[model samples]
Target: FDQNPLAQMVVVGIKAGIGERNSNLSGNPQDVLKSISDRHKLEPTGEPSLQNSIKMVRDSME
Candidate 1:
């Protein structure tokens, strides 16, 4: 298995649905969202749907 896992992760993350409003979650929002999405076993969808929004807020505590 000589696949580039990290590169794949980045690709999946960028396609996760990030937008302007979501473009400010952090100074490095793009990167942060990626981390968040990965943690939830998601594809880095930065849209933060009803479900992910709730999860993101909850995860912030930890």
Candidate 2:
């Protein structure tokens, strides 16, 4: 489904969770990156690209 509303909701929820967690942190760049990586278990150049996309969104929010 190209326009799945559920998928959008899930993304928003994820971003909100990330933002909330980030707000409580020290805001150190490396720490934030590591936190995201650890929480999501992200690996480089994966098929889904969700990790990079989430990271980019998180970076923009900062």
Could you give the C-alpha RMSD of every candidate to the true structure, in order shown?
Answer: 12.7, 14.2
- Residue 34's lDDT within candidate 2 is 62
lDDT of 2 by residue, 1-62 (tens): 23443322112214322322322333345554565556576333324444655775677568
**How many angstroms is residue 15 displaced in model 1 relative to the true structure, after the best TM-score fit?**
27
The RMSD (Cα, Å) of candidate 2 is 14.2
lDDT of 1: 0.41
lDDT per residue for candidate 1 within 1-62, as digits (tens), equals: 12433331121123243222222233444575666665567345435345544455456448
Backbone collisions counted per model: 0, 0
TM-score of candidate 2 on Cα atoms, chains taken together: 0.28
- List lDDT for all candidates, in order: 0.41, 0.42
